[model samples]
Target chain A: MSIVKRVEANDSWYMPAIFKGLGITFKNMVLNLVGKREMITLNYPEEKYEYSPRFKGSHILTVKKDGSIRCTACMLCATYCPAECITIKAAESEDPTVEKFPISYEIDTLRCVYCGFCEEACPVDAVRMGPEWQMPGINGANFVYDIKQLARRPQLKGGIVSVVDEEERHKAGI
Target chain B: MVSLKQSLKSFLQKLDNKSRSIYFLTQGCCSIEVDNLCSSNYDLQRLGYTIDIDDPREATVLIVSGWINPAFAEKIKEVYSQISGDKAVIAVGACSISKSPYVDENGLKLTDVLPVDIYVPGCPPRPEAIIEAIRLLEKTKENRETSKIIYGAIRELG
Candidate 1:
């Protein structure tokens, strides 16, 4: 039932095909030597490359202007997460202004799909995907970012904001 | 008598020069994407690691990537046992290190089954990050040896 292509005498020899490949290689080598062609290979690690603006890298828990964790512990992110990587344990906050705050919030970086759905699901604008794409770790614990790590992340350049202005307006009862 | 520094230097040099063979044991979906590391773009061969070794016995490092279902536990144990001599295990992806949506409580945890030396975490970790983890593992190995030699030298002096 298998179809087989006929091999010609020249094709069976294989020498001509090899020479053709070699010819292309030599041409490129000569071109490269004379600076006729530019090198495509980048010296990475030493020279960092830029990713697209829309690139969803890692998850960050946004904060209020008063330096308080903004998450209401609604579990919207956990519910929306297709991977079910986000876990939030809600507790009544000591602050009279806020109703609930996450006592323990963890996102297993290994399980996260980086879909930005969590950011979309957050009603309070508490979760946002940051620009910190390099999230590699040597151990399991490193990948599982706790509430402390998530809250302290430096605000990314332009991807998503923590709704700081909106929070301020809410506090002013506007 | 060989000095501690001399022994440390020799050990580091030996580790640096030798090429290592890596055998991948895939258990889940996203981990399959790790094959991209061998593509021309990533070029993991340049790092002196030969991936997907034909013989498990020939491999110096064992990479377990993806989910570990309860049914796959016996297979993991078999492959781990088959690899002869001193070998390091790297658990890649979240499912391997922790329980993902794919596995329940009954599913076997990777750390319980085998002594994992390194972990590369991500839904499917980027190839660059995976490469970085390998380098870090090598560095950690060198550090451990260096410390042991230093302690031995100190004891000899005493």
Candidate 2:
């Protein structure tokens, strides 16, 4: 005999759960539709949520005290990049103390996975992930990044902890 | 009167549909290429060029997106060969230009290896520069041929 599905009283089962979820969702939908609550999406260009000081966004090659690229042509970032996106040609500098500089340093933005491992691999704090996140372009070639472009990036005077949304930062202990 | 309006609609439709087609090929290490080329504000089309996925022999632009490996070299060569005679090839990123990293299986010097018509330099180039590159190509060459070729390439990420 086929056991007619035994419906338990305690279990209003799937329908009740679905309705409960629908009710919450419906309430949220109305709330969002009417802007009953404050907005969450940043105004973007006008306003952006704060990110970590170490937030991996744009790449910046920091300079030494002498205003030279901190990279010793170590080839660490180039090797570590899974995308194989970095290009560098090392040259011996005339100043023996400085040693080496990338005669040329280039990154094909089209192919970069943006993993930021290159920044991590650098022994010297030469290349770092900066807070400037806006990066967009067309066709792969236009995305190739240059050293000058990476270096001249505006320093986010907004301190590292400065980016975390004040409200969210209050929520987070860090 | 109906026919005139209909004709005007079709003409307007064609004018609105006018878009440039660009195919990107990856040969070098690719980083930030899309960030530098296709973001909203710096949309390359704003510079009067569109990126399309159609065949290059007729589409007019072919962008080699990354570094060129010997294995992939044959395919890149074929793609260039298949593009229309007036079409141009652009190497967009550094990986496509030089095998900066250690080359075991997935790297090669593309700029030195292939005949690139233009080089858009960047780890990922700025979108503005990318737009500039497209405009430069348009000014430099006129699309003369009109045939389409479709045969090799399009393999999985190796």
Candidate 3:
């Protein structure tokens, strides 16, 4: 346990170790300059890196055929949210065919874990995790997206509708 | 005194020379992901945008990211105050835009404290979106300078 290596003159000067480090750096610099080394660095802004097919990002509430929010105010998404960030204030739907509708639906992006549980819990495929990854804001209040904001999201094709929990899918013929 | 056109030309030149030196004020978890913008994949440095963590005074842009509760609000205000008037503020996350679930009635947003130039809304907006927001800001900035020059010239001629 009390073993100690004897220090040499070369170790004190450290010229050889410094040269070795410099040699590796110069080699890399030359290799990179000549395009011999593989370039892993992506030119961002000009270049875009693709995410996985099943990537989950921001939330978007789907619209029906009439362009109205498809949400039936089932409360399944709110119930399933582990973060409890989704708030849906349900009201009686004007249409007699529908039971209830979310008068005010908001998702706190800060608290959202981006877990697809809410999507999976949805029966009507009303809510979706959009492919939009960017969500920068200047104020905190803007993060709490309202019903209009969610409903207004552009329909990104091949987006996640719902996974796992689709009990009512067979009945609805979706 | 310099002529109106000469002053206007110099003003435009000065505005163009101002590099977007950003100072990131990260508060919560979401900022961790936003840090990926500096990595190899979405290298923001290549675009001449630098994050000066040591000094806010030199920064031309302030990127406010993550959740800002009452406590974080005070620190943000201090940082914002340190930055000069000739600067743009970009809010990067939903939490910075509004009070997240963690905050109550006393929670204060970055907007209430400082003027925001751009708002990129997402839970954690992608690096691409952030870049787009900045690009939009740059375009607007140039347009604003051009309009100012024209207005100044018109006033001088009148």
Top candidate by TM-score = 1
Candidate number of the best DockQ? 1
Q: Against the true structure, candidate 1 has what lDDT?
A: 0.71
Stretches off by above 4 angstroms in model 1 are: A1-17, A32-43, A91-96, A139-143, A154-161, A164-174, B1-12, B15-19, B102-107, B143-158
- RMSD per model, one decimal: 5.1, 13.6, 5.9
> What's the interface RMS deviation of candidate 3?
3.9
Rank order (by DockQ, best first): 1, 3, 2
Minimum summed lDDT over a 10-residue window in model 1 chain A is located at A153-162
Each model's DockQ score: 0.43, 0.07, 0.36
Give a tens-digit lDDT track for model 2, residues A47-107. 4457777656667777644455667788999999887779999998998555588988887
Candidate 2 chain B has its poorest 10 consecutive residues by lDDT at B149-158
Tell me the tens digit of each residue's lDDT in model 1 across B1-158. Answer: 55875776566556444326778887576555567677666667766788757878777678887767777877888888878655678877777877664335645568878988887766676676777777777756544544456445544554
Point out the higher-scoring one by TM-score: 1 or 2. Answer: 1
Better of 1 and 2 by DockQ: 1
C-alpha DockQ for predicted model 3? 0.36
The candidate that wins on lDDT is 3
Task: Report the error of model 1 at residue A62, Å.
Answer: 1.6
Residue pairs with clashing backbones, model 1: A110-B122
